[model samples]
Target: MKSQSTLLVICSAVMLALSGFSFFHRNKTATVSKKPVRVSSNYRIVIDKSHYELKLYDEEGWVSTYPVVFGTSEMTDKMMEGDRRTPEGHFKIIAKKLHPEWGHFLLLDYPTQTDLEKFNTRKSQGVIPANAKPGGGIGIHATRRNEDRFVDYYYNWTLGCISTKREYAKELYDLLPVGTEVTILH
Candidate 1:
């Protein structure tokens, strides 16, 4: 019985050590600069789901790029509600606000006339169910506080929104204005 107790203690110590190491490693690798950069009024965002990157552009050219994660590993265009896929197409930043959990939230104007037309076409063709509805409230935002590991690990944990590091999301929220053009591509 003494020997068994010793082995159990050793195993517990090993597990605790491993968890600590993971925590340290995640924090070290996921750290991002919080320094603010110059904001441009002509800024536009281009999110490439295939590359897991969000690139910012101004009139001059590319400005910066931030690592991003999506809703699903399939990276397919969202079809309907609960699909858990990020949609592809042009969108605009309809609103911007502070989020209680995910930090800064930049709401996107998804389901534009183009998106509606496509959704309706798919419904008519039976590609999507007649009762299906296109989802909304999509946006780009940060992972929850102290949860930068999700972005660092490419976990893709959102319902249908783009996610970045908390610092990066704040930077984006500060730089981008309402009506900014955002394009998502595969």
Candidate 2:
């Protein structure tokens, strides 16, 4: 009877230890490297749609690169609403918010004056329907939790936003601030 009691205690302790380890492992955030480069106030971002990369830069130059996915496989400049294409041009981070599913979202100032002008030209030229509208609410954000494979596999599942892994989004959200310049290119 004493031996059975001892075995029960041992199993309980082992189960507790395993559960703790599993919790820690699941909650741990992955980093790009053992030591991440520090971001400065002069930081800027350049996203290359063709290359599926988001490169970070400071006044000093390139800091790091994060893998990213886009809204469409077309990889062209966004034409109209619901085109699923990511836009190309210079923009700025306008807002930051914590998202329930994607984790961190950095809203961009899309549909700038330049974008509007281009959109108008396209409409007049009949490249798009006269009634077509330019969409808004574009940004860079994280994939849903445990969905980092979307980025790794280049699945391109957003409506028009750029997406990275959850951890990378958190890193960017913590580092970048409003008014930071961002340039998206093909």
Candidate 3:
């Protein structure tokens, strides 16, 4: 009787684990409400770092949202190079690069005029370290092929770039053109 109970417990545990995994990895979809929707080329992207969501919007309403991963120090705004925190505030999609490692890189115009000014102010107030440097190359991108498992389980694991699935990255890359505005919020 004891051996039979142990086997039953193990089977139940396995079933629960498999169900949880399937629930988390399910396909995500969205639908528009009755509100007027804007089907325009110029769309705005909003990255909510706290929630790990990247939302797309237009003048009328929301377009779609995708799961995203952030840096180690995702709660704080990026201050300098190697901070591992995604920057917050207004930015623009500057360029897109196709690559083997990152899949597709949708570059952003970080360190905008406002960002620079804030950095200077922080420096003046001694908020940032004296040797700190304002880093660049922040963008939205995808993980390498082998790294998919890490991104799937460990959600917050990017250097500073926002990461999503390769398929979602491709969709976003195709939809957003250069000069599209992206707003990253805390």
Candidate 4:
């Protein structure tokens, strides 16, 4: 009888110890603090010429898209100084500058490889200025007083850059960080 009682006591102690071990092992398997998933640099920018729109794409999907204004000569592709077509190419957001006169502007890589070729070829033919630099005068700029402020919100205007309205430009200026990839598609 005494041996049976001792056996019961030992069994109970073993069962309790096993249950405690199981609980601790379960908790060890379910750790609480895990590292967050990293986000890659896969942002994109798209431009629609017909409707004059600039769209930004993110991981989840189309993050934001804004209406834009283009050149005075909106129909044809830009060829020279007076041709009013926004430069269409792969560009990086170079810089963000606040111009008291122009409000806010986003600089683009204008006069790219093709532009350089044309510039050099023109200089060889004595058509372009000798000291002129390529890839200049390309950015999102503000509208002047005489310029159509209303339509500028929806359509294309200015020399050559993605032109957003005053409100949109302000928002974009805050969002458009440096080194953002910009692809201006015609």
Candidate 5:
């Protein structure tokens, strides 16, 4: 009877130790994941659509690169409203918003004069439909607030914006300000 009682106590102690280890391991993982990425330089921002990345650079050198997802029509440049295509060009960060749906948004000054001219030229050449309108309101942002679990794992899933992980967007937002140069490439 004493041996059986000792065995039961040993098993119980082992189970308690394992439970403590699991709790500590889970907390450690959560802390690591919650830590934000560090971004120092913010001179220029470049988005490569084909590679699905956003690279940051300073006058001195390249800073960091973050994986990014784009609009559904990833390969094509945005031409019209509701096209679900991201524009390709040199733009400036015009605004920033903490949207209710979109977690964090850094609005870009898309549809620049160059983009408008391209649209006009294409219209004159009959390459694009005459009624097609150049769209505006493009930006870089994170996933929808409620859909955080599936933000950074996708290929292309935005309407007309660049999408990154929520933590990444927060880091970039803290580093970048309005009027930052942003260049998008095919």
Candidate 6:
């Protein structure tokens, strides 16, 4: 009986030692790839459409993120004029305007070009007006005091620009500058 108990103890010790050795061996061999995360020199505007969140990233990680309302209707992609759908693509920030009188303005590069080939054959074209200019004024801006914030937060309500609360709008407009790169992703 004593010999059986001794054998069991020996077996347990051997198993534990084996486990410890294997674990250390695996960890020592594991090599973490040293690579730099690509970051742009310009400001980054990240729009996660699925999550309904807009994040601004600077030289550091995420600088700011505002919970946003998408669109009253499902916003998949933008079409012709008055489509009411916010565009999703890469754009360049050309201008920035602030209005204590109005709000804030962030001019964007719009008319990201949807099916230009089809337009020549088709009667209608998705043009941003020959004179109006494509990808113009768009930015975070303020809203009304008496307005229902819930609706804006719950649904998408901008002509094309991304609008936030007055304070947050100001924050973004102040932190980010013109010539920033903005990306709207699904």
On lDDT, the leading prediction is 2
State which candidate, 3 or 5, has the greater TM-score.
3
lDDT of 2 by residue, 1-186 (tens): 999999999998899678542211212233343235774799899999987888899888888888888888888999999998999999999999998877899999999999999999999999999999999999999998788977766777888999999889998999998999999999
lDDT of 4 by residue, 1-186 (tens): 999999999998899678542211111121112123224366667776665667777676676666666775355445566555676667777888987666788777676787677667877787756665444778875555444343433434456666666666776677667777877776
TM-score of model 1 (CA atoms)? 0.81
> Between candidates 2 and 5, which one is better according to TM-score?
2
- Candidate 1 deviation (Cα RMSD): 5.8
lDDT (Cα atoms) of all candidates against the true structure = 0.85, 0.87, 0.78, 0.63, 0.76, 0.57
Root-mean-square deviation per candidate: 5.8, 10.8, 6.6, 26.2, 12.7, 18.7
- Report the C-alpha displacement of residue 119, candidate 2, in angstroms: 0.4
Candidate 5 error regions (>4 Å): 1-42, 146-151
Q: What is the C-alpha lDDT profile of model 3 across 1-186, one tens digit per residue?
A: 999999999998899678543223324332212334356887899888776678888776687877787776348888878888899999999999996788889999987888888888898899998778888988999877766554454456677889888777887888788998999999
What TM-score, over all chains together, does every model reach?
Answer: 0.81, 0.81, 0.76, 0.62, 0.74, 0.60
* Candidate 6 residue pairs that clash: 70-156, 106-138, 107-137, 107-138, 108-135, 109-135, 110-135
In model 6, which regions exceed 4 Å deviation? Answer: 1-41, 99-102, 113-138
Q: What is the lDDT of residue 182 in candidate 2?
A: 97
Pick by TM-score: 5 or 6, better one: 5
Off by over 4 Å in 2: 1-36
lDDT of 6 at 155: 45
lDDT of 4 at 138: 81
- Number of clashing residue pairs in every model? 0, 0, 0, 5, 0, 7
Better of 3 and 4 by TM-score: 3
Using TM-score as the measure, name the better of candidate 2 and candidate 6.
Answer: 2
As for TM-score, the candidate ahead, 1 or 3, is 1
Better of 4 and 5 by TM-score: 5
Give the C-alpha miss distance for residue 11 in model 6, angstroms.
Answer: 80
RMSD of 3: 6.6
Ranking by TM-score, best first? Answer: 1, 2, 3, 5, 4, 6
* Candidate 1 Cα deviation (angstroms), residue 110: 0.5
